[model samples]
Target chain A: MSKQKAVLSEEQIKTRRGRSVALAVTLGVLVAMFYVITIVKLGPGIMDRPL
Target chain B: MTMLEQTQGLHEDATDLGGRGSVSDYIALLKPRVMSLVVFTAAVGLVMAPGNQHPILSFISILCIAIGGGASGALNMWWDADIDAVMSRTKKRPIPAGKITRQEAFAFGMVLSFGSVLTLGLVANWVAAGLLAFTIFFYVVIYTMWLKRSTPQNIVIGGAAGALPPMVGWAAVTGDVTLVSIALFMITFTWTPPHFWALALVKNGDYQAAGVPMLPVVAGETATRHQIVLYSLLLLPVGMAPYFLGFASVFYGVGSAVLGLVFLGYAIRVWRVREGDAAKKTAMSLFKFSLFYLMLIFAGLLAENMIGLV
Candidate 1:
């Protein structure tokens, strides 16, 4: 027995690509936002954290 | 395969997958207009709070509040898709237009809701996050699901959810609610009825057809108009409460009084005109003016606060 695979049309593929890029951009922004927020929360004493 | 055959195959695959919405359609789920007002009021509240917040944290707090408000809006569209399909104003919304499914909207709303609340907690404080969570819950469950269809006083009570943003902003700064924040809350709270009832007057038929018990639909236009005037009158003092409470300056007080008077005048026009196109035009005018009234009131407070800071 052969397994059936889902196939996407050209338009669907394009849309999928668009969604992926948007998600990636959003995640990147979130990462940057968290980093900045973390630094802001830590203040000038951030380097004083014990390793 | 020939070009035509390949195209046909692609079409078949696309059909099988269903209609995929564009990014804009997803953004539409957030109700950006309402989010803007939320952002404005929340920012005002943050600025008006006694303590100083770092500009970056303040920006992040506003961002999170806006996202939380948008998340509630998405959840509202998800729940109200049925009625949204029937109403002229809402029929073109992403869900009703079949651009997005309910499940997708629900997931989007939930993700943003949790993300915003958690992020706000991590950055600001738990009190603000807790308020945001409550706001989302109140808007989604208490207002949209329960009160909206069941009562004409839906927006009256549910208006609390909208009124909470400023309080949330205040909490983010002070870590506790205070009388000044409550004064800010009261302004928006008192303003909501007249603002919404005015729109309800014009959209009576839409609400009727959609079976949503808007004030005009449930209690008739006369009562709604009367309520609008009454609320508008009540709003004058409430709107000026910040100034009276010593939080805002005389500029805000005078501005709020003038705007409140104009808002009342519109409401009176809405009350007097009760037939045909003239009625709708008056109602629409009031509705439009209501937006500016609220925006200007908040802007005045925000401006005063900024001046005080300087």
Candidate 2:
């Protein structure tokens, strides 16, 4: 049987997989940053004891 | 003209009427139904959050999220024009129909994306801003480009993009990701497969012709039916998370459970029907009810918050 040829470079393969997860992580961080700042500002007011 | 030429002439004439790339058609490219769901969920998240926002800012925040969601939808449609042209279900979309050029769609999407992100960051908070930016990027780059053509698992993973709106709305209010907001995200994420698979069951031929590796095409009808049932089952408990978290009330709990059961029953019917016109009807019914189910769950939460019962 003929041997199978590998067509894509390892770098190319890595980039292909890296792009999706990287994008997800990058967005996750952006969302997380917004989350922290908003919490810091609104936390006190929301948790305040109502008169 | 020869017979072939006459047929070709008729085909061209048919395409002319079918290919209306008008201004109204371009707006329809934004997937308004999906955008409406994003807007509604984001609204519920904002209203449910504990802090009191100035009504104007709240409106601005929700509007920004809606615009950001629309921007993602536009970019998705723009990039997927080639694939859209191949799929009968999507062939009438603006870019695919030649109503809007790819470049024009790209520009519109980028402008809206940037404007929405910056505006939300300025008016609402950095958290909302960041979520907006990531959401745009996720849908455009990850879901539209990377996932759609590459895998049968596209909708499952890319469901995260659609689930971000409520989290963005929550961030707008609380400026932090909390258990409650994440739970809201999870509910949508879990519900997505069941909702989409129902539609996919009805549109299997379109997906097959388009060469998209949708679950129904890649996995076949039997697996698609089974997975729909499984996800609908999982969705039942997740739909009630807001009530358990004290972000909603008993009304929401009861409403969500009843809706979840109804959804599950439809999924079960779709699974049992299997094939033929009956199966198609079952899938179509599930598809319609799933939309109402999602809307009702969010509406129940909004009503609970309005009454100060959360």
Chain B TM-score, one value per candidate, order as shown: 0.93, 0.91
Provide per-model DockQ scores: 0.52, 0.02
Candidate 1 chain A weakest lDDT stretch, 10 residues: A11-20
TM-score of chain B of 1: 0.93
Off by over 4 Å in 1: B1-19
- Could you tell me which 10 consecutive residues in candidate 2 chain B have the lowest summed lDDT? B3-12
Query: Over the stretch B185-270, how does candidate 2's per-residue lDDT look in tens digits?
Result: 99889988888889999999878866678999999989999999999999999998887777777888888889999999999999
Q: Pick the lDDT winner.
A: 1
Query: Weakest 10 consecutive residues, lDDT, candidate 1 chain B?
Result: B3-12
Model 2 regions lying over 4 Å from their true place: A1-51, B1-22
Question: A8, model 1: CA deviation in Å?
Answer: 3.2
lDDT of each: 0.88, 0.81
- Candidate 1, residue B249: CA error in Å? 1.4
| Predicted model with the maximum DockQ | 1
- Residue B170 of model 2 has an lDDT of 87
